[model samples]
Target: MWKIYLLAAISFLNGTSEYVIAGILDKIAEANHISVSSAGQLITVFSVAFGAGTPFLIAMFARMDRKKLLVYALTVFSVINILIAIITGYEMLMSARIISALSAGVMQVTVLTLAAVLAAPGKQGGAIATVIMGQSSALVAGVPIGRVVASHYDWNVIFIGIGAVGLLFSVLTLFAIPKTVAEKPVPLREQFKFFMRPRIAAYLLITFLWLGAYSVVFTYISPYFLDIFGMSNHGVTTALFIFGIASAIGAQLGGFSTDKWGAFRTLTGGMLLHAIALLLFPFIGQFAFLFYVLLIFWALAAWSSGSPIQFQLISLAPAAASIVLSLHSALGQLGMAGGAGIGGIAVKNGLLNYLPWIGAFTLAIAVGVTVLDKVYLNEKQFKETQSTLFIK
Candidate 1:
C-alpha cells in the first residue's frame, strides 16, 4: 500500500510538471516580455523532448534496477524544475523545460511499469488506473492551484512550489519502493521489433490520431472560452474545474469499460462520444450552461481512452511491457506536440473558430480506425474457427 502511494506520488509530480505552465502561461509571457505565442514554445519544446526521450531512455536503462533509475530520474526532474524557477531568458528557460521533460518522460514510464509489476494478476487495469489517477488529479487540482499561486505570487513561485513537491515525493519513493527488476529482460533491438508487427503499428497510429485531435482543442480551451463566450477568469477557472472532475470520472469509467467490454469496443465508444462533443462546442457557445455541460462530456470522452490504450499495448508486447509502455507514452506526447503546433498555427492564422472542426476531423479518423480494428478482430476470429473445424 505504501509503495503504491509512493508510485502514485511520482505520477502526481509528473502531472504537475506537465500542466503547471498551462495555468501560468500568461504570467510567464509577461515576466519574460515575450508574446504569448513565443511563450508557447516552452510547451512545444517540453512535449517534443518528452515524446522523443521516452523510448530511448527506457531501452537504454532496461536492465538497470527500477528503484535506482526512478531515484535518478526524479532527482534530475527536481533540479531542472528548480532551474526553471530561476531562469531569466527564453532560451535558458526552454533548455530547462526540455531537461525537465526528459525526466518527466522517464519517470512516467517507470511509474507505470512499476505499478504493473506490483499489481496482482488480473488487476493490471486497476493498478494502472490507480497510478494514472495522479495525472487526472493534477488536471483537477494542480492547474487551479498553480493559477492561484501565479495570481498571488510570481509565476516563478509556481515552478518553485512544484519543485518542492517533487523533491518530497522523490524522498518518499526512495524510502518506500522495494528494490525490483524486470522479470524478463528485453534487448533494445527486440523492443524495437514489436513495432514491426502490423497490429502494434495500428495501435500506435490510433494513439497518435486520438491524442492529436484531443489536445488541439484542449490546448486552446482557455482562449476559446475567453473569445467565444466572453468568459472571465473566474468563469474559465470554474469550467476547467468542472472539466477536471469529469475527466477523473472518465478515467475510472474507462478502466471499467476496458475490463468489461475489451479495449476495441471501449475505444470506439469513447472516440465517438468525443467527436460529438467537439462538434457541439462551436454551436453551444451561446448557452453558458449547455457549454459547460458539453465541456464535461468532452473531458470524459477524451480522458477515458487512456487506460484502455495502455492496457492494450502492454498486452500486445507482454515480453517488453516497459518498452512498449514507454513507446506508447512517447507517441502520445508526440500527438500532443502535433496538436498544439497545429492549433497554434490555426489560432495565429486567425482560424480559431475552425479548431473544433479540426478536432472533428481527427476524431473521424479515430472512428475509422476503430471500425478497421473491429473488422480485423472479426476476420481473425473467423479464420481461427475455420482452422479448428478442419482439424476436427
Candidate 2:
C-alpha cells in the first residue's frame, strides 16, 4: 500500500509538471515578455518531445533495471523542472520543457508497467487507476493551485513547486520501489514489429483519433471560457476544477466499467458520450449551469476512456506489453499535439467559436472508427466460435 501511494505520488508530480504551464500561460507570456501565441509553443514543444521520445527511451532502456531507470527518469525530470524555473529566455525554457516532457513520458510508462506487474490478478484496473487518479487529481487540483501561485507570485514558482515535489517523489521512488529486472529484453526492432499486426495498427489509430478530438477542445478550454463566456480567472479556475472533479469520477467509473463490461464496450460508450457532450457545448453556452453540466459530461466521458484503452492494448499484445504501452503513450501524445495545433490555428484564425465544432467532427470520426473496431471484434469472435463448434 505504501508503495502504491509512492507510485501515485510520482504520477502526481508528473501530472503537475506537465500541466502547470497550461494554468500559467498568460503569466509565462508576460514574464518572458512574449506573445501568448508564442508562449503557447511551450505546449507544442512538450507534446512533440513526449510523443517522439517515449518509444525511443523505452526501447533504449528496455534492458536496464526498472528501478534504476525510474530513478534516473525522475531525477532528470526534477532537474529539468529546476531548469525551467530558473531559465531566463524563452528558448531555454522551451528546451527545458522538452527535457521535462521526455522524462515525464518515460516515467508514466515505467510507473504504469510497474503498477501492472505488482498488482494481483484481476486488480490491474484498480492498480492502474490508483496511479492515474493522481493525474486526474492534478487536472482537478494542480491547475487551480498553479493558477493561484502564478497569480500571486511568479509563474516560475509553479515549476519550482513542481520541481520540489519531483525531488521528494524521486527520493520516495528510489527507496520504496523494489528492484525488478526485466523478464526478457525486447529489442527495438521487435518492439516496432508489434505494429505490423492489423489489429494493433487499428488500435493505434483509435488512440490517435480519440485523443486528437478530445485534446482539440480541452486545449483551448480556458481561453474559450475567458473569451466567450467572459469568465474571470477565478471563474475559469472554478470551471476547470469542476471539470477535473468530474474527470476523476469518470476515471473511477471507467475502471469499474472496464472490469464489468470489457474494454471495447466501455471505450465505445465513452467515445459516444464524449461526442455527444462536445456537440452540445455550444448549445449550453447560454446557461452557465448548463454549460458547466456539459463540461462535466465532456470531462467525464473523455477522461474515462484512457484506462480501458490501455487495458485493451495490453490484452491484445501481452507479450509486448511495455513496447505496446510505449507506442500507446507516443500515439496519445501525437493526438494531443495534433489537437493543440488545430485548436491554436482555429483560435488564431478567428474561428475560436467554431472550436467545439471541430471537436465534434473529430469525435464523430473516432466513434466511426470505434464502431468498426467492434464489428471487427465481434466477427473475429464469431469465426472462432464457428471453428470450435465444427471441430467438436
Candidate 3:
C-alpha cells in the first residue's frame, strides 16, 4: 500500500508538470517573449512526444530491470524540471519538454506495471486507484497551487518547487520500492503482439476515445469558464478545485466498482456518466451553481474511467500486461492531442459550445466498443484471444 502511495507521489510530480502548464501559459509566454500560442507549443511537444514515443521507448527498454529504470526515470524527470526552471529561451524549453515527456512517459508505464506487480492478490485495482489518484489529485490541487504561485511569484519558481518535490519523492521511492523485473525479458518487437487481437485493440481504442473526450473540453476549460460564465481567475481556480476534488474521489469509486462489480460495468457506468454530463454542458452553465455541480460530476465521470479501463486491458492480456498498458498510455496521450485538435477546430468554426457534443459523440463510440466486445466476445473466446496476443 505504501509502495502504491509512493508511485502516486511520482505521478503527482508528472501530472503537475503536465497540467500546470495550461494554468500558467501566459506567464511562460511573457517571460520568454513568445506568443501564448507559441508557448502553447510546450504542451503540444510534450503530449505528442508522450503519445508517439511512449510505447516504443517502453518496448525498447523492456529488457531492463523495472526498478532501476523507474529510479532512472524519476531522477531524470526531476532534473528536467529543474533544468526547465533554469534554462532560458523557448527553444531550450521545448527541447527540455520533449525530453521530460519521454522520461515521464516511461515512468507512466513502469509505475502502472509495477503497481500491478506489487499489489497484494485481489487488490490490484485498488492499488492502481491509489497510484492514479496522484495524477488526478495533481490536476485538482497541485495545478491550482502552481497557478497561485505563478501569479504571485515567478513561473520559474513553480517549476523549481516541483523539481524539489520530485527530488524528495524520488529519494523516498529509491528506499521504499524493492528492485524487481518483469517475469522474463520479452523481445522488444514482440510487444506489438499485445495489440494483435481484435478485442484487445478495441479496448485500446476505447481508451483513446474516452481520453479524447475528456481532453477536448479540458483543453479549454479555463477559457470556457471565462468566456461562457464570465468567470474571473479566482472563480476558475475555484471551479478547477471542485473538479479536482471530484476527480480524485472518482478514481476511488472506479476502483471499488471495478473490484466489486467488474471492469465492464464500471467502465460502462463511467462512460455513461461522462456522456450525460458532457451532453448537458452547453445548456448547464446558465444555471450558475448547477454548472459547477455538473463540473464536479463531469470530472468524476471523466477520471473514474482511469482504473477500470487499465484493469480491463491488463486482465485481457495479463501475460503481456506491460505492453498492453504501454500502448494504453501512448494512445491515451494521443487521444488528448486528438481531442485538443478537435476542440480547436470547433472553436475555429464558431462552435465552441459544441465541443461537448463532439466529446459525447466520441464517448458514445467508446461505449459501443465495449458493448461490441461483450456481445461478440465471450469467456472461452476471450481466453483464446488472449493466447493469440502473446509471443511464445
Candidate 4:
C-alpha cells in the first residue's frame, strides 16, 4: 500500500508536467511568441514520443531491477523537465518535452505493472486507481497552482516547480519504496497475441477515440475561456480547479464503481454522464455559476471513465495483463496525439467554440462502439454494462 502511494507521488509530478499546460496555453504562447495552436503541438509531440516509445523501452529494460528502474526513470524524467525549464527556443523545448515524455512513459508503465502485480488478491483495480490517482491529484493540484504561479511569475516557473517536485519524489521513492518482485518476462510475441482478441482490439479502439474526444476540448479549455467567456486567469483557474477536484473524486468513485457495479457498467454510465455534460456546455458556459455546477458533473464523469475501462481490459486477459495495460497506456498517448492533432487543425479553422459539440459527437462514437461490443462481443464481456443496463 505504501509502495502504491510512492508511485502515486511520482505520477503526480509527471502528470502535472504533462497536463498543466492545458490551463495556461495562452500564457505559454505569449511567453514563446508563438500561436496557441503551435504551442498545442507540444501536446502532440509529447504524446507521440510516449505512445511510440514505451513498449520498446519495456523490452530494452526488461532485466533491470524494478525499484532501481523506478528511481532511474524518475531521475531522467526530472532532469529532462529541468532542462525544459531552463531552455529557450521552440526546438529545444520540443526536444526536452519529447525526452521527458519518453522517460515518463517508461516510469508510468513500470508503476502500473508493479501495482497490478503487487496488490493483494482482487485489489488490483484499487491499487491501479491509487496509482492513477497521482495523475488525477495532479489535476487537482497542478492546474490551479500552476496558474497562480504563472500569474505572478512566468509560465516557465511552473515547469521549474514541477521539475523540482519530481526530484523530491524521486528521492522519497528511493528511500520509502521496496524492490518490486519481478515476474517472469512475457515474450513480445506472446504479449502481442492479446491484440488479436476482438474484445481487446475493440476496447482499445473505443478508448483511443474517447480520449481523443476529451482532449479536443481539454487541450484548448484555457484559450476557450479567454476567447469565449472573456475569463481572466483567476477565472480560468477557478474552472480548472473545480475540474481537478471532480477528477480526483471521480478517480476514487470510478475505482469503487469498477469494484461494485462492474467495469462495463461503470464505463457506460460514466460516458453517458459526461456526454450529457458536454451537451450542456454550450448553453451554460457563460454563466459562471451554471458553468461551474455543470463542470463538476462533467469532470466527475470525465475522470470516472478511465479506471473501469482499464480494469475491463485487465479482466479480459489476466495472463497478459501487463502487456494489455502497457498498450493501454500507449493508446492513451496515441489518443492524446490524435486529439491534439485534430484539435489543432480544427482550431486553425476557427472552430474553437464548437469543442463541446465535437466532444459529444466523438463520445457518441464511443457509445456506438460499446453497443457493437454488446451485440458482437456479448459472450466475451466481464460483468459489463450490458448485463446491468438490460436488467439481466
Maximum-lDDT candidate: 4
The runs of at least 3 residues in candidate 4 whose Cα sits more than 4 Å from the true structure, single-residue gaps closed, are: 1-4, 113-128, 175-181, 256-262, 379-392
Q: Determine the C-alpha RMSD for candidate 1 after optimal superposition of all C-alphas.
A: 2.8
Please provide, for model 2 over 199-277, each residue's C-alpha lDDT reduced to its tens digit, 9 standing for 90 to 100: 6777888888888887777776666787778888888788878887898889878889999998888988998889888
lDDT of each: 0.80, 0.81, 0.82, 0.83
Candidate 4 C-alpha lDDT tens digits along 45-158: 999899988778877888887888888988898888878878889988888889989898888878877787778899998898788878768789888888889888988778
- Say which prediction, candidate 3 or candidate 4, comes out ahead on lDDT: 4
Candidate 4 worst ten-residue window by lDDT: 378-387
lDDT, candidate 1, 140-172, per-residue tens:
988777767777778888787778878887787
Q: Compared with the true structure, what per-residue lDDT tens digits does model 3 show for residues 1-392?
A: 88898898888888998988767765787899975456656776788899998777877787888888888888898899999999998899999999999999888778877898999999997887677778767888887888788777889998898778878877887788888886665664676776778778888899999998987777767667767778777777778778888888888788898999989999999999999999998887568888978988898888889888889888878877767877787888888878777776676567767888899999999999889888886565867768988744
**TM-score between model 4 and native:** 0.89
RMSD of each: 2.8, 2.9, 4.3, 4.5
TM-score on alpha carbons, each prediction:
0.89, 0.89, 0.83, 0.89
> How badly does each model clash, as a count of residue pairs?
0, 0, 0, 2
Give residue 143's lDDT in candidate 3 (0 to 100). Answer: 77
User: Which TM-score value belongs to model 2?
Assistant: 0.89
Give candidate 3's total backbone clashes: 0
Weakest 10 consecutive residues of candidate 2 by summed lDDT: 182-191
Model 1, position 108: C-alpha lDDT score = 85
| Model 4, residue pairs in steric clash | 264-385, 265-385
List the pairs of residues colliding in candidate 1. Answer: none
Between prediction 2 and prediction 4, the one with superior lDDT is: 4
